[model samples]
Structures are given as structure tokens and as C-alpha cells.
Target: MRVLAFLDGTLADPDQAHLRVDDLSVLRGDGVFETILVTDGRPRELGPHLDRLARSAAMLDLPEPDRAAWERVVQLVIDNWSGGSEIALKLVYTRGVEGDPNATPTAFALGMEIDEKVKRARAEGIAAVTLERGIGTDLMERAPWLLLGAKSLSYAVNMAAVREAARRGASDVIFTATDGSVLEGPTSAVILVRGRTLYTPPPTIGILPGTTQGDVFRAAERAGWQTVVESFPASELTSADAVFLASSVRKVTRVHTLDGQPLADSTELHAELAKVYDSQYD
Candidate 1:
């Protein structure tokens, strides 16, 4: 529960008192955000996360973020964190109050302790269910207003999807396109392994480009594995030697079951992939 926040230029406690009702993030969910993983007081894959945040902000037509300010704030939160080997650093900036387009954006950097659930999932694999996202891969290109590729504050739909997965006795949700193509997880990226080939859905398919996945791919390439970015069907998860949901915070958690069907043996492959992941940060 340890937490700190940098609100605008002010460093303060991240309690309810620091939040404003009129903030666009609270009122209309008009904002962009990034969740970074800090291990041993070091924030991993920070450059890519910042790049993605800026890209998402551009997509939303929001003001560009102040990188130096954000870096200072990130340091502030990290310095204030008292416990935990891992931390979740969340950066948020909204378009500001409605009708005041020129209003200064409401920005904050939050540092909080990582949840124990993440460690449990990494230790023991998780079960997932495939849910239709009701949109195709081409929709992002045609309907840019949908903001499908941007990581925005409007996550109620994703939260509901995860809740629905919980109701169905699953730990997470893998969203498939309307055409049954595996898109991604509600908050993570999907990766499948067959032999030495690692597959992840193409970012062109309207999925957020995963910084963790990118790091894994780079590590995999260095380990003499082939990495492919392509649109894959949900059935691919069933046929793969291993399946994982990857994100900055979650890292790589093997998926033990998909739609109640057990996946292939993931223990060996999970260890190998994890070795590659660990080697990168070390």
C-alpha cells in the first residue's frame, strides 16, 4: 500500500485528497498512461515505455509530456518507496477539464507496491479464456478515433472483460478479433511458442506494442530463436508448445489453460524464456 504521487509540479501523497473531480481522466477518461516495472530500484524498459506514452498522447491529441519532469517525478516516487523488490510506476496525464482545451493537462507519476498476485501467477501459471473484442484488425486503420492502439485511461471495458473472466473461473482474458484472430490480453500481450519459433500478434492488428514483449523478442533472437510478428488465430494457443501473457508489470506468465483446455507442456519452455528475460536485465 506504499504510494506517492507527483501531481503537476507538486510532489504529494497519492491519497484521495490529491485527486480532482473535474480532471479529464476522472470525468471523460481522456488521457494516456504507462505502467513501468521497477526492479531493484531500477525501472526497466523505460525508454520504450516513454516512447509509447508519447505516441499514445499524440494519438489522443494531448499535449506532449515533459520527459525531464517525469524523470524527476519517477525518481521521487522511487526514493519514497519503502518496501518491495518490485514496484509499479504509473504515469498519467489527461487532456484537462472539458471545454477548457487550453487548460494545463493534469499529470501525475504514481509509485505503488506491486501486487502479490503477479508473483503467484509467475510462480504458478494462470488460466485464460478467449473473448471476442467485437472488432477486426483493420478497424484501427479505418477508425482511428476508436483509439484502439493507444493506452488510454478508458479501461472500464477491459476491467469488465477481466471481471467476466473471473466469473468464468479464469484468471485472465485473451481478446480475439471478431474474426477469431488472437489479438492480445486485456492488459498484456500474447506470445506463443512452437519449437524455436516465438510468435506474437503483429502490432498492426490494433494491439498495444508491448515493451516487455519487445525485450523478450530481442533476448530470444540473441538466444538463437526465431521471432515472428503475425496475426494468429486463437486456436494457435492450443497447438503451441507454450503460451504466455507478457506486459511490463506481469513480465511473462505462462498460460496453463485456454478455454478450459490444457495447453502443451510449458515448464521447460517457460524456464528457458525466463532465462532470456532475466539475462536482459542482469
Candidate 2:
């Protein structure tokens, strides 16, 4: 991974920086971030990415970085290219050091070569299990201070679940409420397909609204495909005309199995939807 750390208006290497854990971003996880897929050497759905980033920043009540400045940094990182069409560009902003010593959180963009495994999973559908419990809404509401829908540095819990899913022989996990309503995955947004229509858990479900989902759904409409936002139980998913997960990285992948049960076939839909999506973004 090649890094260009943006610290107080200067770009430096992470190893050379005096970054510490005391920063509020580190101490309290007070920050917002985004993972964007670089297409044609550019960030796909950049507008939506910025929109979500701003919304996340507002939710966290953290200092907001100028979009133009940040966008330049990303472009610089790409122009300084080390030669990988598939690059994972991540922007992390924090409130700086927590204590007096390392007080200000230094923001930097760390870029890495996209993993071949993730690419393969996009081409080949993944097997996943439905999580029995979705994240609590009360924490996000009552504690309005909580990260909630914001993509913050506090991702330990989410990463843990994804790791566990891999350990269990699945590519990812789809979160669901105790009542069986599906939500989202650890890193990707959830999108379920039925016939030519596409459905996903609404943002109101306490899931991070997905940019990729928005892109495809709009593309689906342009391509004459049906798209809807509504609630459905896990049992209904078992009977879905087609079930798949969508994200910028994974694109559109049909979910073939869940909890030892073979899921329905949505390969043709996946292909058609993939065309509409990939034509614009991938």
C-alpha cells in the first residue's frame, strides 16, 4: 500500500509522522470515512461518495475537510500511480490526538492495491449467512452521539463479524433483525433481486445507505428494470426470485446459499443488472 498522509496542509509518509492513539479520533472514534472504487483511474460515484461523507461528518459532529482539497489529494494519489487499475482509495479524517501530547488528529489517504480475492468474489457469487441481530437503533438515536450510520474509525465490531464469516467458509454476512428483516453486510450494501425488480433494506433500517445501490437502482430504472425499497423477512429471501449483494467492489453478485440452503438462481438478472451498472461505473 502506498500512502500520502495529509497533515496540517502537508503530504507525508505515515511512518515519518508522529501519529498517536490519544487523538480523539483514536481515543473516541470521532471521525467519518469512505471506501471508493477507482474506475478508469477515477473514483466511481464520487458525488454520492462525497454526499455520504458529508452526511457522516455531520452525524459525527467532527471537523469537515474541504471536498475540493480532498478530491485533489485523491487525484494526486492516482496520478502518482504505482500501476494498478483496481485500487482501494480510503479517506480517514480524525479529530487528532486525544491527549495534550498527540492532540490533533492527522488525516491521510492510504491507498492499496485492490485484492484479487475481492475481485474474484465479484465475478463468482458468494455464500453468506443472515445475522440474527441487526445493529441497535436506540444507540444511534438516544445516544445520537454514537457513530450509527457514519463510517467511522470505530469498525472493530463490523470487521470482527466479516472475519468470522470468512472463518465459517462464507464470503460475507448479511445482517438481519431478530424478526427476520434483512439489513446489510459488513462492508457492502444489501440488495435483493426478484424477477426484474430490485429491493434492498431502506436507510431507515439503520443500515448505511449504499452509493452503489443507488447507482444501480437508478441505472436499473434507466434500463427499464424495477427497483423498490421495502421490508422483507429472511423467510421471504429464501423464496426470492433472486438474491444477491451489491457494492462498488463486488458489483452485483448473486447469493447462492445461506445457512446450508441453496438460494434461488438470479444469474441472468445479475448479468443484466451488471451490464447496466458496469456500463456506467465499473
Candidate 3:
């Protein structure tokens, strides 16, 4: 469904907007972005999403969006959204229109409806394949200036990884490194249950520091479930009692299989966690 676009402050129709594809955000993926869920016309975890949006923009050396105005834009989009049970509100700030690296920055905020099938996947669990895709420690060894943790606009690689996983008959990819250390997912956060302890990779290891996962941890604590963030190899995942991917839109979804091996269902915990997450937005 189509929604209005808010660039800096001006509003325009996305279908007729004049956003340049070759802008710095497109050419170099030099931008920071956030995807917040809109539930019943209200944006979920807006404060944290804006917090990270600014943080990510700072990391990429891009100008931050005006936080107060950005929030209003999201609400406006929710109000204008067409067939929305819920929608994904996205705000993007880029080091502007294609030019020298020192050019001015451009930014935009809009809402996109969450795909219905993806929403359905939350009810029915998702299958995943492990992709040996880790953000290497040596940024200088690769592109030092690129925003590693920033939700930069360069999604080609991430899309490719998801496609690779889909090729293996899985819905998504759980990334790992050459050394077997498990990382986050192509788009979602990786969450695994190790019997009593719930484990996720720490942000120190080049993860996006998931805001939704952060809430889940707090909720788990309230639910009397143990939560921990530590680094471990993907090999450890095979032995995990259950696995799932978490995100604002999907909420919390079970991972039934990893590389063809079945993972025990964590339906009970998923339900418990869902209630906690759903309550936050409500």
C-alpha cells in the first residue's frame, strides 16, 4: 500500500517523488535507517528507534534527522496508510545526492506495509540456513569508513544472503563466521534457547544491537526466564533446544529447522515473549 513520504519536512507521494537513486546513500550506501512497527496507528519503541537512528547516523558521519519531527512523520504515515493491520515505518538519512564524498546529506521517512506472508510466517515458524557471513573484525582491512553497525542502505549483500538461504529451502539465513561464531540474521536478530539460558550474540561482536531484542530480554527477566548475551560458534546452535528470529515486525518467531536439522519448538516461550512485546506497543 502507498503512504506519504516525508523528506526532512516536506511531504510528497512516493510514487511521484523525485528521490535520486544515484545519491550517496545508493552509490556508497552511506546512510543510517530504522524500521519501527506501527500498531493500531502508533509507532512501537519509537524512542529507542530514534535513539539508534541518531547513533547510526553519527557512526556513518551523516546528519541526524530531527528526532521530534521524525516521530510526527511516522504518525502521519500511519494515519495515511491504506490497508494496514500494521505497517513498517522506515526513516532513512543519507549523506545526500550523488556527488563527491563531501556533498550535502539527504534524508527521508516513510511507512511501508509489512508483507502479509512475512506476517504469516510469525504464526507458522520459519526455516533458516546458516550463512558463513560475519562482519569481520578488521574494518580497516576492508572498507574502514563504511558504517558496520549502522543500518546503512546497502542491502544488496543482505538480500543476497537471504536469497542464498532461500535457495536451500529456508526462509532466512543465520550468519556466522569462518571460525563458526554465530552472528545475527540477514535481517532479523538471532535468538536461541540453551535449555535454561536464552542466548544472543553481544553487540561487541558487530551486531546491530536490536531494540526489540533488548525489550525481549527485559520481558524474559519479568517472565522468570534467564537471558544472556555471549559469543559462541554456530556449531553450538545445532545442539540448541530451540532457535528463533526476532524483529519489531515479526515480533518473535520460532525457527523450526537450521540447515535441515529440526529444532525443537519453543512455542510456550515464544507465546510468553510475544505477549510481552505486543504489550509494549499496545
Candidate 4:
């Protein structure tokens, strides 16, 4: 099942929700968005997602989103949701019609069921390959206009990387910077386990800061594990005790194989980590 709501506190049929043909979002992918995981009709970490949405909009020189208004839309979707246990609630804000100075922005919220494939990944783990991101680690610092950390709608390159991974017989990808530093997955954050510590690349290296990663780290810390934010080369992944990808919808999934090489079985560790992650809802 799916539900749709507009930013103006109005509900709409998903099939009827439409945008102008010349909208910047359609013309040039000019906008920002966030996907929040809704469990039992409640959105998780909603505030952080909205904050990131505004941050991304600002990065694109778009007006800051009206939080209260957006929140109302989210509530509308939740109220109308008749789905199962989980839903991927997406909030989208776009630059409106092209060449229309009087045009206002387009915004909406969509709630859809989580795909079975995503659930399978969470349960059975995934195989991933490392792909070159074609940008130096310092590019974001040198050029702020690149919008490296923003979750904008411009995802053609990211999708292409995923397709490349599929072509390589992998289900996912771990993007590596031109300088050989590990960045993140196209739709998730990378976490490496070594000893009793968890390591993830810092946001300064041009990756979307993972909200789920932050939650997992906090959970891990409370469970007597150490978490660090630092950048390491792709080679470090091969030597790590275990590797996982963290995202809002998927939460966390073990990387069973990387570049066709099998990784250590961390089933016991994965369960413990998953336990802490689930404890947040309690």
C-alpha cells in the first residue's frame, strides 16, 4: 500500500499527484529529499531527517523547508498509512517550474511499503564491490559547490555505480575516492569492525552522514563497544574483522563478500549489533 500527502496539509492519490513538466526537479534534478523509516506507523529519527533535508536544500540554494509544514505532511501520511509493519516515507522538495520567477517550490511526502529485496539484504546480507567515485577526498573541501554531502535528487551517477556493481555480479557498491580512501555506499554508510571498535568514514571526506550509523554507534557504545569516525583506505576493509552497510530503510546489513572475496562470518557479532539497534525502539 502507498499514501501521498502534499506539503500544504492535504492528502492526495498517489496516481494523481502530479508536477509540472518543466519543474526543475524534472528538468534538472534540482531538489533535495530524505527517506525515513516508518515502523508501526511512527517515523524514526524524523527530526534529523528533516534537518538534513533543509541542509541539502540550502546546499542547492533552495529555500529552507518549513519544518512544521513538512511535519504536518508526514503526520498526514502516517495517519493514512494502511500498510504492514514498515514503510519507507520519503519527503521531497523540488525547485518548481523552469523560467517562472513567480513559481513556488514543489513538495510532497510519499509513504510506500519496504521492498522484499531490502528485507532479504537485512537478513541474508549482501555482496558488494568497490567502485571509483572519481573525486579526490579533498574535493568537497576545495569545492563546496560540488554538494558532496547533500542528499540532493541528483543521483544519476550513484545509480550508474549501482548498475556497474550489478554488472560485476555484486548486489551493492562501496564507493572509493580517487585517492583510494573508502567513502560510502550509494545508498548507505560503510562501517568497519575491528576488535571491539566500530569505524566509519568521517563526513569531511564527502559522504552523507548516516543517521542510522549514528544511532547504531550510540547503541554500540551503550553496549560497551567503541565507535570512531575516521577515513581509511579501501584496503582496510579487507583486513577488518567485519563490514556492514548502514542506511535508514535497511538499518544495517553485513557485507558477506567484497570484490568477490568472502569476509569473516560475523553472525554472532551481527546479532548483537542488531539487538542494540532494535533496542532503540523499546
lDDT leader: 4
lDDT of 3 by residue, 140-236 (tens): 2266465566777888899999888878998888888656778888678888887667889886667678888887878777767899898788888
Residue pairs clashing, model 2:
22-98, 23-96, 23-97, 23-98, 96-104, 96-105, 97-102, 97-103, 97-104, 97-105
Candidate 1 residue-wise lDDT, 1-282, digit = tens: 556666545667566686668888888999999999998888989889889999999999988888878887777778778888888999998888777757888888887787889889988989999999999899898889999889999999999999999998999999999889999998999999999999999888898999999999999999999999999898778988999999888889999988888888799899889989988777
Writing each residue's lDDT as its tens digit, candidate 2 over 1-282 gives 665646334556645745665667767767778877787687888789888887887887666667887788777777765757766778888777665664444576766777887878777778988775545533446665655577777888778888878787787888877567787887887787777788887776577889989998999999998889987777777888778787767767778887667888777777778899888854
Deviation from native of the Cα of residue 266 in model 3, angstroms: 2.1
Against the true structure, whose TM-score is highest?
4
TM-score of 4: 0.98
The CA lDDT of each predicted structure is: 0.88, 0.75, 0.78, 0.91
| lDDT pick, better of 3 and 4 | 4
- Model 2 lDDT-worst window of ten: 132-141
Superposed model 2: Cα runs more than 4 Å off: 5-10, 14-18, 100-105, 134-143
By summed lDDT, which 10 consecutive residues of candidate 3 come out lowest? 137-146
After TM-score superposition, the amount by which residue 147's alpha carbon in candidate 3 deviates from its true location, in angstroms, is: 2.7
Off by over 4 Å in 1: 7-9
TM-score, cand. 2 vs. native: 0.90
What shift in Å separates residue 225 of candidate 2 from its native position after superposition?
Answer: 0.9
For all predictions, the C-alpha RMSD in Å is: 1.2, 2.4, 2.4, 0.9
Stronger candidate by TM-score (3 vs 4)? 4
Tell me the lDDT of model 3 at 241: 79
Ordering by TM-score? 4, 1, 3, 2
